[model samples]
Target: MTRKEQTRLQVLNGVLEHQVTVDEAAQVLGLSERHLWRILAAYRKEGAAALAHGNRGRRPANAIPLGLRDRVVALTQKRYQGINHTHLTELLAEREGVVLSRPTVRRILVRAGLTSPRHRRPPQHRCRRQRMPQEGMLLQLDGSHHLWLEDRGPWLTLLLAVDDATGTAPYALFQDQEDTRGYLSLLQGVIERRGVPMAVYTDGHAVFQSRRAGRDETNRGGATQWSRALGELGVTQILAHSPEAKGRVERANGTFQDRLVSELRLAGASTLAEANQVLGDFLPRFNQRFGVPAAQPESAYRPMDSELDLGSVLCIKELRRVAKDNTVQYHGRSLQLFPSMERTSYAGARVEVQERLDGRLLVRHREQILTPQEAPALAADLRAQVAEGPVVVARPDPDPTDWNPPQRVKTPVIPGPLAGDSIWYEDPARKQVHRDLVLAGMERARYQGKRIGRPRVSERPEFEQQFTVVVERIGRGGLSRRQAARELGIGYATLKRLLDSQEKSCTKPATSLSLKPDTGEDY
Candidate 1:
C-alpha cells in the first residue's frame, strides 16, 4: 500500500479504539470532521475487515504469462546475449513477436543471468550553466579524430554540429583530416537545414580565429577567409578562451566518439556512407534520452541572407579579366566566353572566376554566365596554325664497327695499406679490381639499371677517383655496363662482384649529403 493509504488505516485503528476524539483525528488526518465521523460510523457498522479495498484481490488483465516471461528470458540468453536491454527488447519483439517494455525485459534477463556487464559511470559534479532557450539558437561545432573503422582503414575525422539545447545533430560528415574545406561544407549543410543560427560557439582553432598582426592589438584581428565568409552571412563567430567555454560541443564530441563508434560497429557500418546512414537513425533516439527543455519557446535562428553567394564565398580563387576575344586562361585550359548582342568588346573587364574542387570552370561575366565550349573546327584550325611551329629531324645512321666505344679515362685509385701502412703499393691491377668492384656495386644499387642514380647522395671524395669514371660514362647516356666491362677487358661477374663489395662497405647515411643551393638541374 501507498504511504497515504497506510496512514489512513492507522487513523481508522485509532478511531476504533476511541483513544482520540473524531475532531482531533480529523485534524491529524487533514480531513473534514464531518467526513471522518461518517467514515468511522460506516466502519463500526461494517466491521474492521470490511474496510479493505474491494479491487485488492483482482489481477491485471494485461499481465504477461509466466511461461511467456520465461521464454523471453531464455531467448534473451540464447540469441540476444551481450546486447543491451533496449536492443534485446527490440530484437525479441521483432524476431520472436514477443513484445515487452525495456525495463520488464531487463528484469527478466537479469533474473535469468542474461544481463549485460555494467559500466561504471564517472562521478557527476553539479554546476550552474544555461543552454540556449531553443534548438538552432546556437550550434556547437567540433571535429573528432577517431578510428571509426577499427583497423580496416586509416584514422578519420568526424566533423559534427550539434544543437545546444535539443542535442540534435543537424550536420555530420567524415573527412580524412580536419581542414577548412570540411568546415565550409559543414557550414553549408547547417545553413541549408535550419537557416542561420544566432551564433556558432567553437574552440580557438586557427580556422576560426584570426591571427593578430602585432602585440599591441587588443582585438583578435586579420580576418581569415573563413571568418570573412561567415561575416558575409551575418553569423557571429564566438571564439572560446577554454574548452569549458564551449562545453556543449566538446562534451558532445566525447560522447559521440564513445557511443557512435559502438553504434557503427553494431550497425555493421564499414564505410563512411554507411556510418552516416546509421547516424541519421541513431541521433533522434540519442537526443530523446539526453535532451532537456529549453528556457524559452521560440528559436532565435534568423533567415539566411539573400545576397549571400555561397559558391564564390566558399571557393578559393582570384578574379581575372577576360581577353579581347572573350577567353580566360587558367591551368592551361582556355575558358572561352561568347559575346551577346548587347556587348561589344570583352577586354579589360573584371569577371567572377571560380575553380571548383573537381577542376571545373565557372565563368560569370555580369548576369551572363558562360561555360567553356569546344571551339568550332574552323576556329580550331585557325588557332592551331597561329600556335603551332614546324618540327625538325636530324641526320642519322653511323656504321656499326665505326661506333667505337668512347675512350676510357684511367684515374688513379688511392689504395689502403696491405698491413697497417707498412707498404704503399701502386698496383694498377688492384686499382682496376677496386674500380670494377665499385661500378658493379653501383649497378646492383641502381636496381639492375631499372632506376639510374638520381644523385640522392653527394659524391664522396674518398671514392672520387672511382666515381669520376662511372659518372662520366653515365652522363654520356648511351654507355652500358657490358661496354664498360669490355673496355676494361675484365670478366663481367668479377667486376660486378667487386662493385657489390664496394657498395656494401660504403653505406653512408643520407644526412651525409651536402645541401647546396639550386643551380638549375645540372647536379
Candidate 2:
C-alpha cells in the first residue's frame, strides 16, 4: 500500500481499539469527524483494504480514449510535425476537427514519447523586488526589437512603458527604429492620457545615459535630447545597471516577442501604421489579462500641473545662441526669429530651439514662443531677408568721389613692440600691465647702457610677484589653490601658504601664522 493508505489504516485501527479518540484519529488522518465515521464503518466491513482509494486502479471517466491519444501522437509526428503544444492545439481544433485543450494534448504527446517534456536549468535564487504601492510611482521602460509582424513585414522595435505598481502598460508603439522622437511621442501620449509618472526605470542606453567619456556628471547632464526633455519635465530617470536589474521590462519584452508577434501575425499587419492600429485593440485585452491591481487604491500620479505645457516639455530642446544676424542654427538648418514684444533683436542672445515631435521647429525665449521661419538655404543672406528691421544696403560700388579710399598712417612709439607683448597670454589683464612695465623699464634701461630683451623667467622678481598675485586672485574666486598653483607654475605648498596668509589677513585678525620647528623655534 502507499504511504498515505498505510497512514489511513493505522489511524482507523487506532480508533477501533480505543487506543485513540475518534477526534484524534480524524485529526491525524486530516479528515473531518463525519468523514471518519463513514471510513470507520467501511473499515469494519472490509478490513484494512478498505482504506485504498476506490478509483486508484481505474481509468478516468473524462480521459481521452486510447485510440484518440494514439491518433494525436501519430498526427503530431506526421501532419503537425514540429509545432508547439499550444500551436498544435490550435491547428488540431481548426484543421483536424480534434478539439482538445493544450494540457490534454501535451500529456498525450508526452506519454507517447512523440515529444519530450520541456527541461529547464534550475533557476538561481534572486530576491524579487516588490512593486510600488501606488500606481504611477515608477514605470519600467524598454524597447523590444523583433519581427513583430513575423514574416509578413520588416522588423520593428516596440517602445514600451509598463507601470510597476499595477503592471499596466501605459504606452507602446511600433517604430522603424528606437529613436528619440518615438520616445518623445510615447511620453506625449502618456501625459495626455494617464498623466506623467513619478519616475521611469530604463537601461543605460545612449538615450538615457551619456556614452561619451571624461565628462563629469554636471557636464554630462542633458547630454541626450530625450534626457533633456525629461529633466525639463521634472521627471526622474533611473538607469538600470544591467538587463536583469529591469527584469519587469525585460520579461515584458519576452512576453511581447511571443504574444504580440503572434497577434500581429494573425491580424495580417505588415506595416508600422497597421501594426499600431492593431496595438490599440490588443493593449486593452492585454491589460485585462495580465495587469494587476495596485496595493493602494489611490494613484501616485500627481495631477498634471496647470502650467505644464506638455508640447513644450516633451520635445527635443537644443540650446542655440542667436548669431549676429538674428538667426539661430540647428542641425545644419538656420532659423530666423521674427521681431517680437520680448525683444527686437535676438542677435547674440541664447534661444532654445525645440524640434517638436511633429517635425516642426519652435524658437522660445523666456517661455515666449517666437515665430521662426526656415531661413533661405543661403544662410549668409538671412540677415538681409529677415532681421530686426528692413535692411539698408550700400551700393556694392559707390560713386568714386563720394567713397574715397582712406589712407593708412603710423603712430610712433619710444620703442618697437616686443615679441612678448603681441603673444596671447592666459591672463590678458596681467599681460597688458606687464607689457607697459617692460616698455617703461626698457626706456629707463637704455640710459644705463643695458640691453632691452625678454627677462629670464626664473630671475624676474616682478614677473614672479605678478604671477603670485594672479594665482591668489584666482584662488579667492573659488579655484582650488593647488589647481591655481599648477596653472601659475608654483609649488603647491607655496600656493597654499600664500592663500592661507591672504585669507587670514582678509577675513580674520591680521595675526601671523607661525610654524614651530622641531628645535622649538618659530619659522
Candidate 3:
C-alpha cells in the first residue's frame, strides 16, 4: 500500500487493540467517529488489506476504452499529424464521429507519445498595466499579416482594433496589406459602429506616424495620412515604444493566428470574400466567448457628433488648383467644375479634392461642394489627328543652278592646317617676343613684389598713413591694439605690422609690449 494506506493501517491497528479511542483515531485521520468505526470494523475483518480503497485495483465504469484510444492515436498520427491538441480534438469529433472531450483526446494523444503542434514559450517578466476603467477609453489597434487562409488563398493582413477595457475586438478588416487606406476604412468603420474613442494605442507604424520623428514635422510633410485622419476626428494617438507595452493586441494577434486560421480551414474559406464572411460570422461568437465586462459601468466613448460628416473627415484630401478652363485635374482625371451661385467660375481658384472611400471624387472650395464632371481623354483624338510626315514640295528648281558654278570663281580657296605651328621656338620673331614677355614678368616680380597680388592691410598706403594718428591716440593709454583692430575691422597682426612698419612705432601687440596677460587686449 502507499504512504496514506500505511498510515491508516497503523492507526486502525492501534484502535483495534483498544490502545486508542475511536475519537482520537478519527481526529488524527480528520474523519468522524462513525466513519472511523466503519473503517475499524473493516480493518478488523480484512486486516491490512482493508486499508486500501476497494476500487483502487478495479477499472472505472466511465473510463475511455483502449480500442477508442488506439483509433484516436492512429487518426492523429495519420490524418491530423500537424494539428494542435484543441483543433485535433475538434476535428476528431466533427470528422470521425468520435465523441470525446478535449482533455480525453489530449490524454490519449499524449499517452501515445504525440505532442501538440503549437509550442508556446514561457512568459517573460514585465510591468503589467491595468486596463481602462470603462470601454472606449482606449483602443489598441494593430495589423497582423499571416497565412490566415493558409495555401487556399493569398496572404492577407488583418487590421484589428481591440478595446482596452473589456478586451473586445471592436472591429477588424482583412486587407491586401497594411496600408493607409485600409487603416482609414478601419477607423471609419469603428467611428460609425462605436463612437469616437478617447485615445488610440498603437505601434509606431508608418501609416500612423512619420519617419522623421522628434523634429519639426510641419515642414517635413507634417503628419502621416492616418495621423491627419485621426487629427481630423479629434482622437488622441498613443504610440507604443515596444511590443510588450502593447501586449494585449499582440497576444490577440497570436491567438487569432492559432484559432482563426484553423477555423478558416474548417470553413473551407479559399478567397478574400469568403474569409471575410467567415470572420464576420465568427466575431460575434468570439466576443461572447472572450470579451469581459469593464470595471466601470458607463462607457467612456464620446458619442458621434451629428454635425461631423465622416465622409469628408475620413478621406484622402489633395489640394488642386482649378485650371483656367474650369477644370481640376486629379490623377490624370479632369474634373470640370460647374459654376456655383456664389461664384461664376472656379478657374484661377484653389480647391480641395477629396478622394472618398467609395471612389467618389469631391471638389470643394473650403466648405462649398462643387459639382465636377470628368472630362474625356484627348489622347486618342490627338493621336488620330497626327500628320505622318512634313508636307513635301519639289525644291524650287534648285535655285536655278547656282551650280552655274559662279564662273567668276570656280575653285574656292580653303585654309590649310597649321602643321608647323608646334615649332614656334624655331621662328626668330616668335622667340624674341616670348623672351621679352618673360623678362617683363621677372622685372615686375622683382620690383613691386609686395603689391603684385592683393596685399595685406598693413602694406596698403592708407593704413601706413593712418598709423601715426592711431599711435598718438593709443599713446594717451585708453585704447589697445586689439580694440583698435576691432574698431578698424582688421586683424591684430595686421594692425601691429602697420604700427611697427612706421618709425619708432612700438605700441604693438607683441610679447615685449605684453607686460601683463591683458596687455594689448584691454577694451
TM-score for each of the candidates:
0.49, 0.55, 0.60
Stretches of candidate 1 exceeding 4 Å from the true structure:
1-127, 210-222, 305-317, 321-334, 340-346, 355-360, 365-523
| Local accuracy by lDDT, each model | 0.66, 0.74, 0.77
- lDDT by residue (tens digit), candidate 1, 1-523: 6677678778988877988888889999999999887777877787654456767787888877889988887765665544577666766776788888988987887777775643456978757577778877788888888888675556788898988877767778887788777888888877777778877888878778755643322222566656766777778888778877777777788767666765676677877678778777877766776677777768777777677666666654445777777777665556777766756656778776665544566776777655665433345455455334323233233222332323444433333323332222344544454565556666665655544444332233443344347535745876776676565434456445445555565575322323232222332
Top-lDDT structure, candidate number: 3
Between 2 and 3, whose TM-score is larger?
3
Q: Summarize candidate 2's per-residue lDDT along 1-523 as a digit string, tens digits.
A: 9988888888887887899999988888888999999999998999877888788789999988889988899888876665567766876897789999999998888877766333445999999898899999998988888877767888899999888988878888889998888888888778877887889998887777767643534324536777777777778989899898888878778767766765676677999899999988878877887899999999877667887777887787767789887889888787988888768888888778887777889998877888699776664354324432332333243222322333322322222133333222133333444465556666667878875653333444454456556654774786766667567555666555655665656554322323211221211
In terms of lDDT, the poorest run of 10 residues in model 1 is 511-520
The residue-by-residue lDDT of candidate 3 on 1-523, one tens digit each, is 8998888888887887889988999999999999888888888788888888789889999998889999999988776766888877777877899989888888888888998878989987777799999999999999998999988999999999999999888888898999888898888878878889999998988888787754643313767767877887789999999988888999889878887887787788998899888888877766786799999989888877798788887887877788888888888688888877899888889888888888888988978987688876566544433322222323222232132221221222222223332211133343444555555555666676533433444344555335555666788987888888776556687567555654353465332232112123323
Off by over 4 Å in 2: 1-61, 65-100, 108-121, 213-222, 379-523
lDDT of 1: 0.66
Q: How well does candidate 1 score on lDDT at residue 439? A: 64
Better of 2 and 3 by lDDT: 3
Higher-lDDT candidate among 1 and 2?
2
Whole-model lDDT for model 3 versus the true structure? 0.77
Candidate 3 Cα misplacement greater than 4 A, ranges: 1-57, 67-83, 86-102, 212-221, 379-381, 384-523
